[model samples]
Target: MAPRSAVLLATRNVLYVSIAGDLIVAAIKVGAAAYTGGSAMWSEAVHSLVDSSNSILLLYGVHRAKRTPDQEHPFGYGREIYFWSFVVAVQVFALGAGVALVEGVTHVLHPTPIAFAEVNYIVLGLSALFDGATWLIALRGFRRGAGDSDLFQAMRASKDPPSFMVVFEDSAALIGLVIALVGSYLSIRLDLPILDGVASILISLVLALTAVFLARETKGLLIGESADPAIVMSLLRIAREMEGVAHANGILTVHLAPRQIAVALSLEFSDELQTPALEIKVSELEQRLRALHPEVIAVFVKPQTALGYAEAVERRRGKTRQIVFHTPSPPGPA
Candidate 1:
């Protein structure tokens, strides 16, 4: 696996490129929309502007998240990235989707003939080239981070929001660009300007869906999600194999940041070890874990018997099943 610093540098580079591209694209799109009076082009301008702003916010979040740990907030501001990412999702929905929807609806109600058709075509083609380039950059970074996993699985398994957020936004922009191209063509060819408005609405729907997906993903990260199951299992195995540990009942791991993990292990040490010896064993375990996994920033060892841990796990499982079973069936027949 590539070093975390290398991954972060790559992510920052992609975001910088995206911001520059979006600024250029937005300016061209707005100019085209003004000259052509095309609703779809106007919506595209809004999309680019929103994406640019999101890129800026994400950069700011990365800066804030890197602040050193302090007394007030011991875990650092690592989740700041997730918070800003969630904000980006909201903006995409409210400004990008909501504005496009409203503008499209108005245009449909009172259709406007498009002028300067060639200008829109030229601008959109250029925008597609720029957006495509940025999309590829983001895609390459994501693929490197994803390693062996497929795209969908990589997305689901990814902990880094900045890396994935750009990919999602750029993908949406590319699709919206295609939609605008089609809508403009149909409006001019069919002599039905309302198709331009319809195209705007379709673009808005795309933005809305992207926003929703981004929100859901970012929310999980913001609320505290576990590290990978493979990592957790490995930690457990290491603990069990140690000379002083009788059992490794359970392991809990959470991502404090994309590159930082906090691990808490439930361990039952050998009966022969006294308090001082137990402390020594705990120190040794922590050192070994850190040496093996540099991302693990904190290690918390909780002494618990095998029976107690088993009971706790069973109780949690039972509660989970109860919740699932009692989840109100969707308005069943009375």
Candidate 2:
């Protein structure tokens, strides 16, 4: 199978596992919350439900993103994944964090003794076990995608949001479960039922932070992020080494999808090379680039003098700087 297809299948499998685990956990949490009237348990139930929904949305995004290139969208529908992932982040903030915060605050205002606190503890323990399993699955996928990078670094470097997003969501869920267990225990032992509400608030905070981080990460991709620096360097090196290439001015690379990159190169051919020779050289360079980096889907080579290319780049940079300087800043608080 193709690499892109492989990646999509792997993502779908992981999401399927997550969805199943979340459905089970949510059901258990809801029953426990109904029976024991624990605010934290209720919050957990909601969290699980939201997670399940997110998995479905991510799967849908993956599906939509895989659509073949069309006349309307010549670049294909790759950015659809970024768009839907951003939506997932917003949903996490709205449905997951927003609901949890409101529920927590309501419980804090009207503190109520938790019935059968032991039941909540039991459910939380089981839920933790289940969530941990799903978390491990996500972590393994993320680690494979990351190669040798650490978790935080992997998250930042990952172009595929679903890979890391699931990891973050599951990690938060596990932490929330631990907090709920502690809060339930403390509430029972100390007769401080309000601690349950505080626990829910803490869980909401975790979800909110995760949502914000996901949003920040996905925003760049949605707005057309560049390809990896290493990939860009490799492309330039390949072009420069070509026989008829006088100078490789610069390379511009952008990710059309996680595994799809579009490359544009400005090359100054040797004066000694004829038009036919330059055409052949360009084709050779394109093939070499694709061979070196299979992710490069499209390549455009433009014939230009090195001096002209440099001047154009400088003008572009100056305009960007001017725009940045002239942009209005938000007003500071009084």
Candidate 3:
């Protein structure tokens, strides 16, 4: 809806880069943990595994939301993006946070010895490097697309998938890497291997917080939130400007999706209007309304009063025309 070409391409690039990097890093972390016998490395590996899953889920949402509108869903599947994003959040909470918390608790209860401190550091460094590139690209996309809008509004209105998911996941991954490094270094230096598990707990907490935020937003969309307050005000103003419109009978706007809306309104007209002219007035109102609010995909206008005014005007015009026709014929004959 908004200029989507740049945003779409950026989204795709961000997805691929993040997915590849996360998956690779996850594998390396898991393997390094197994080889070095470091609980911290294991916790990070699990965190990355969940990150990879969340990225995949976001990609799925991006693709599904792009599907064309069908008979059962004439409004299009744009909202499906939010649905899939919700699933991603759930995965972050369930898979990432849940696993990390469990591992952290286990380490706190029963400590393990650290053997792969050097390897864990190397793996963490590599993960950070890869995350940096993905984050920069995603940030650039957000800057170009988000502009003055708030992040939630941008995500809500964005037709492009990458701008939302890629940016979020990449940012999370970068932060997670830093946290993992700190936990690992602390565990190795203090000879308190259980601290590695504590790192996992912290990662879990971060994921949970992110998931909760996303859940609240996505749930609002699923239940249907109102459009921007400004847009609603704009529509009301435009309706009041109509020539025959007494006032906007009422204005109702529903957010069908991030970029689409359905509007239904009642219109009260003057007491002395005519049918033919009323048709012209209706057409004018529709055109002006569309121009004022592009998100208004559909508008239904109902006349709030009886057609008495329009019918009276028609009757008056008919009588006037009849008298003129008769008068003109008599003059010619004379």
Candidate 4:
């Protein structure tokens, strides 16, 4: 099977495992919360519930994103990942973090007793272990699929593989579990019930921060940011190596989808190849490009007249000069 297909399948499998883990964790936490009557456990339970929901949303997005390209959306539904990911963050903040904060603040004002501390602690510890293992699975999938890029960037450019959501959700769940344990211990041992509330507030803060970060990052991709600079440079190198391309006049690379890019380049031929030779060279170049960058979804080569080539060179020079003048520089020798 193709690498892309393999990656997609691998992602799906990881997500499936993650979803199972999430459901189990959520069920355990909810049961513990109901039985223990501990505010910290309840807060953790809320976090797990949202995380489980987010996993379901991610699975849906992944499946939707795999739909074949259509007339209205020729690029397919890859960007749907961004929308769904953003929604996940919003949901986490609204349902989990917001509720926790309100309850925490209220409890701080008027604290309450907690019962069945031992059971809550055992449940939290088990949840933490499960979350940790799930996170490792996600991390492994990420390392296998993302190549040399940053983890977040790899995830952003790629489809909404369930493993990506699994990673974030599990990591968050682990933290929430730790906070709940601390708070529960304090409530039961020290008779400081407010620590339970404080713990909840701290978990909320973590969730809010997580939501804002996810929103900020995904929003940029949803709005159509450029592909990675390294990827662009690789494309440029491929163009420069083409037999007929005398000079790389200009290249425009845009992300049509995560890990899929469209390239439009103005290239100059060396004294212009003969018709047959140009055709052969172009075919060869296209083949080479596909081999070099699997991420390039489409490439359009624009032949330039000599005069047009000169104009393009001059434009690039002008742009370079402007960039040099406008860009800030650190202090240096005169």
* Index of the highest-lDDT prediction: 1
Estimate TM-scores for all models: 0.93, 0.93, 0.79, 0.84
Q: Number of clashing pairs, model 3?
A: 3
| TM-score between model 2 and native | 0.93
Tens-digit per-residue lDDT, 201-301, candidate 4: 98888788877766766677667767677777887898898766888877777665556777877777878578788777777777787798887777788
Span of 10 residues, lowest total lDDT, candidate 4:
319-328
| Regions more than 4 Å wrong, model 3 | 1-6, 149-162, 272-283, 305-334
CA lDDT of 238 in candidate 2? 89
Error of 2 at 315 (Å): 2.4
Ranking by TM-score: 2, 1, 4, 3
User: Residue 314 in candidate 2 has what lDDT?
Assistant: 83
Quantify all predictions' global Cα lDDT against the true fold. 0.92, 0.90, 0.73, 0.77
State the RMSD for candidate 4. 7.8
Per-prediction CA RMSD (Å): 9.0, 9.3, 11.5, 7.8
TM-score preference between candidates 2 and 3, better one: 2
lDDT for each residue of candidate 2 in 1-334, tens digit (9 for 90 to 100): 9876888899999999999999999999999999999998999999999999999999899999889998999989988889989999999999999988988899899999899877887899899999999999999987877888688987987889989999999999999998889888888899999999998999899999999999999999988889888888989988888888888999888888788899999999888888888788888888998888988989999999987787779888884322223768899999
Q: TM-score: which candidate is best?
A: 2
Clashing pairs in 2: none
Q: On residues 34-115, what C-alpha lDDT tens digit does candidate 3 reach at each position?
A: 8877665676787778777777777777677678888999888877777877787788788878887888889888978677
Output the worst ten-in-a-row residue range by lDDT, candidate 2.
318-327
- Model 1 poorest 10 in a row by lDDT: 319-328
Candidate 4 or 2, higher lDDT: 2
Candidate 3, position 273, lDDT:
71
Model 4 misplaced stretches (Cα beyond 4 Å): 146-163, 274-283, 305-334
